[model samples]
Target: MGSVELPGPPRAARPPRPARAPRPRRTIRRRALPYLLIAPTVLALAAVLGYPLVDLVVLSFQDMTRRELFSGATPPWAGLAHYRSILSDGFFWTVVGRTALFTVACVAATMVLSLLVALLMRRVSPWVRTVMTGVLVAVWAMPVMVAASIFRWLSDADYGVVNWLLGLLPGLDFSKHNWFENPWQGFAVITGVVVWGAVPFAALTLQAALSQVPAELEEAALVDGARPGQLFRHVTWPVIKPSAVLVTSLCAIWDFGVFNQIWLMRGGQPEKDYYLLGVYSFIESFAVNRYSAGAAIAVLTVLMLLGGAVVYVRQLVHLGAAE
Candidate 1:
């Protein structure tokens, strides 16, 4: 046995295993960095937007009178009394119609004008494009209040530039026209202002979209004996459809909840001409001291804006599917 043990081969030693590279350490900062960046914005929105929204919801359901609001009493459950009142109220319906008309008119005018401007700008020389852009910027740069003031003066019966210009025209009589006193004229003025204000953005957006149309595509259409109008319909229209829809959607949304422009134009006339949801709500809350009623009107307006957004989303989805 001893001899056998001596004959045993020398024990072979294994070589050392190579060391592995350490995995990258994830710090609290590294793991949470993305969330941290967004957390502040989320928190801010929660405090500012979220709190007020919740408050408005609660305010909408709970009855709040100026007297009760001023005095510190918990409001009793109004249920949908405010909403019911708004629904039954004749004035409210009138304002609803007015707002709808304004929205429609503004959308139509803005779309048509913007499309035309975009088309022209898309094909013009650099200097011409620059001039167009400069003019748009100049108009767009004016403050809302200033623009409103200008419109107010321009539409005035006593000293309107429009009336003056109309007087100059051979067939027109503008001796004393109160533009704000008539709903139709008021609407026209409002729509004109809104469209004029919106055109620059639409033109810029549409021009960019038009620029993306391949030159070859248009050239090919021409080679195929396609006239300018035919080429527009068959080629450019499809290419610009998405952009146009986006602009339209935006215009719809904006006009749906418009406040200052319409309010300023309405000028506090209880007459048929002087009512829009925004103006009515302001009058109710401030002039008449009907806080809950005003809140109801506000809620309705919000629903309208929300509806517009829903429509926009649907259009965008449809467009995506089409693509």
Candidate 2:
């Protein structure tokens, strides 16, 4: 045993293992960084947007007259009184119907015009396309109020270019014709203005979408004896359907709440016969000093728009599933 122990070698020492740095602190910091970065934006939005919205909702539930507003008196709680008054009124329903009609007309016209413009752009030379795009951008950049004012001036019964142009036509005396005197004519004018303003944006969006369509697919369709309409229906349309839907939805939303052009052009005058929801809301809120009623109308308008948005989203989902 003593002789065997003498032949045994000593064990070598093991190296020390490196210690892992703590990860929990770093992980927490990394997670918190994004929230910290976005905190300012969230706070700003709450202050600017959230507060006004909350105030509007609160005001809607209170009977806040102009006198009360000025006298710093607390508005009495009206609960659903405002809503009931607005809903029970026949004029309110009429205004709502008019609003819906106007929105539908404007959206339809805008979509058609935009699609035409987009197709035209696709066929144009580069230089022509650039000039057309510039013109569209200029029109889109024009302020709503300014454009409305210009249209109002142009459609004026006296000293207007529209009347002068119409006078040039034989047996057509539009010099004394009042466009805004009639509800239908006023609606048409307002719809035209809105469509003109909206078409540029929709056209640009559609053009961009069209550009994404595979040229090879279009060429193949053409080679297969597909007519222009067939080629578009089968190839171009499917490719641009999403963008068209989006543009149309946006146009509908904007047209639904169109206030500036309508207000500037008509101002709910002529016995309020041509009144849309926006004009009616303004008249109820400011002109007549029924703030609560106006707020209720505004709320209802928002709900209607929300319903439209939901429908639009569902359509988008269905389209995606089809693909």
Q: Which digits, one per residue and each the tens of the lDDT, describe model 1 over residues 23-79?
A: 557765598889989999999999889877767767777777766888888877898
Candidate 1: TM-score?
0.83
What count of clashes does model 2 give?
0
Candidate no. 2 TM-score: 0.84
Question: How many clashes in each structure?
Answer: 0, 0
Residue pairs clashing in model 2 are: none
Provide the lDDT at 195 for model 2: 84
- Measured by lDDT, the strongest candidate is 2
Write the residue-wise lDDT of candidate 2 on 213-253 in tens digits.
99999999999999999999999998998889878888888
Listed in order, each prediction's TM-score against the native is: 0.83, 0.84
